[model samples]
Target: MNFFSYLASYFDFDLKILPYCIGLSLDILILYPLLTYFKWHLLSRLGVTLKDKEVIFSSRKNNFNLAYFVNKYGDRNLRIADGLSRKLLHIFSGIWHLVFLNLVIQDTRIAWQAAFVKSLLIIALCSLSYSSNKVFGLAGIMYGATSRIRDGLDGRKNFFIAQLAFLNLYVLVFIEYIARKNISNEDNLIFFSFFIFLPLIIGDALGEIIGTIWGKQKIRVWGVGQINRKSVLGTVSVFLGSLLPLLLVVSLNNLPAEWWLLCLSVAATTSTIELIAPRSTDNFFIPVGNALVCLIFAVYVIHL
Candidate 1:
């Protein structure tokens, strides 16, 4: 047996999935150095190791370049530069996505390619959101794609843009993946495709656009004397905008009247989450929270 067969013999799982893992791994491994070698300066921005520190210089009997192989997280010289770091995280994110995505499609009739594309598109939207700040960036380097989002990948510090990062999208995707398997009603796999994503796309876009055009009154998110304040009209825009997804679900799924009420609940809850969601965690919370609300309404109240 060759490489794949040998590996397969060692680990006992479906052999078909090996190709997915292999292909993704190769892409990440090959692209990482190529991407990072040129942009080593990203290390400093992310507060990781610096690049210009003479690769030939190392403490391992002057034989190894420790920086290249090193790995750690957060403001330190222990890890490689931002490029590889980003790529590594990207690969991790992608693999986890595939894992969850596969779990999502399990027992369902949806096409894997279509689901993968849709999943990537969700990340792309998150990419746009994270880039709402100048010198934009991505989630986990946008699966190791783009550059920094403001002050780099440290989501806790840059929570605003962090919402746009892959972590949030990861949460949304994973939830949908599991929701598909567990939720007792409407398992056409459309909820993940439509209700989950469209709200963010439409609601978020509307919030920004309308807020930019007509936002006047400021609303505090963290409480009195907080720095990050949003406009009332903008917040309203998000609430209204979030409804479109549920409405779409209603229209397409022919959901009962109770679902309409739940849809409204989704919109309202997501908007509220946006307002009070802890600085660094809204991405995961908003989508998952909204989804949970919908599921609860569906299973218990609507009995769908």
Candidate 2:
């Protein structure tokens, strides 16, 4: 049998879904390296040096080259570059989900298969990065891409844990979809997935980027990083960023008034989690929290 057939038989998944899995893998393999290269070049231009030894050792001990930048180019430049890199990755993630969503709307079964494969690949890569001591190869590339957000002393550990938590949410949703097989509520399933991802892609990302640039008032918070201050403006950005997209989706679908309440409630939950979640761990909490709140609201409140 061919590779797709083998995978289908071995994994007990539909062979038709292999194309989506391959496409997502190719996208990550190609785009991720390019984005990492671009980020490295941009930071180098900004005089943010990431020496091999420093990246592997000093960064592990300190705060992922932030101190070097602070000493050389000042905190403002570092923050700007950090924010710009974050925006680039977040935009990529947002685009990826947009494509993934089209497939879900077309065929939930196929989409879930693709998502399950993608999640496994991501978790494997992250696990590999966590085990390696050297800052080279795939681990290096990952570090290059996410070093800013993973700036804490325990950043890599935090990143791996958070990814496990984040991807587990997707896996759980996929399980729910498969178990129910309620074709009538397929559209509702699509909406549920959209609500879970929209805030994470838009609200969480923009909150950090805007906060880095314009946030003057620092509100101290708890987290795993050296920097624990969040901006008032950034918190506002999170709420608005989440709410606006939800509103658009509701309007376009002509969803019920209850969905409007759902939108507002979700936006509030997302921003609140972002505000209070421990540093990079928000990457874990935001989606899972949104999923829980959505489930509670759907089951008890609006009876979705």
Candidate 3:
């Protein structure tokens, strides 16, 4: 317990950081599966054939980007499996954390901590539900739900507004976490502000914007880049998106460059997995990977 305490202090006496990261990561995980389910259902509605082999997926549409998807390692069924694993983990982890929070609150009379943790639990649940629905809606859109709806400026703007609103809410909750942690007096807080907050705002926004614009993945069903689903471009966006958070950690703590590098590596790897992992289960996997990395960081590099 002393060693754990020392490590926690070394990570800046903030128990919330890793847990919050885990929570945020869970949001991403849920989004992945929900989005993928929508995508597949939409494609299937448009008559896209999805055949799975031992470890590969093939679409019957010859001119479609089945070639590219395959090149990217096609395996829809396996992807689905991976996604399920991740989503389950996310639920399990969230429950575990909630239980842990209850125990901590009982043991200590830290008003802010108890309140903040409770708020986090509520926000997390809400975010999970909202993201899940949004993913389904996006899939419905792709499948031509409300087909008469024009894909014009108004529609796109509406979409952008909704997405931005959700993301902003996430940021706001993150700010709440920072406030609850009350690290403002620490010298490192300044670094966290610029690196963490700034980058997160930019990265998530840019990823969505890019995904909307040049996301040229040929819908397996439509045989064209008709659907505004994820793109290779959007996938690469994670590199820039994740860098902000990692940079924040590095800037604040004066840790070795290797530490930051590792953080980036974890983010990149998880983001990539999220990209390819099946939508049916991504809600589970993304957080597990992200939370695992944060915990490892806390235990190994970041903690004293």
lDDT top scorer: 2
Q: What local distance difference test score does each model get?
A: 0.48, 0.68, 0.39
TM-score of each predicted structure versus truth:
0.47, 0.79, 0.35
User: Candidate 2 residues 1-304, lDDT tens each?
Assistant: 4434433533567677777888766646766677667766776787655663345322375445555546667666656666676566766766685566465436655665676677688778877676454554677555555656335466566556555665554445543543243233434766777788789888887887888778873798876666667898899999998999999999999888899999999999999999988876776778777777777766666665
Question: Mind sharing the TM-score for model 3?
Answer: 0.35
Relative to the true structure, candidate 1 has a C-alpha RMSD (angstroms) of 13.2
Q: Compose the digit string of candidate 1's lDDT tens values, residues 1-304.
A: 3444433332343545544544433433555344444334554564444332222111112333232433333322322232244334444444444444445444222334333344455445444544333121332323223332212233213433443443443344444444544456665445544455445546654664465346753665552111244677777888988887568768887866776887788888877876677543554566677767756665577764
lDDT of the structure predicted as candidate 3: 0.39
What is the C-alpha lDDT profile of model 3 across 1-304, one tens digit per residue?
3434433433342564455445434533454355445445544553345542201111122233334433344334323332233223333434443344334333222322433444455345433443222333432322112111112112222233223232232333333343334332333232322232222333433443454345554422211122224566656665576676667657777766656765675657555654665422333344344444444444455542
Candidate scoring better on TM-score of 1 and 3: 1
Instruction: Rank the candidate models, highest lDDT first.
Output: 2, 1, 3
- Highest TM-score: give the candidate number: 2
| Runs in model 2 lying further than 4 Å from the true structure | 1-16, 49-66, 130-136, 149-152, 174-186, 300-304
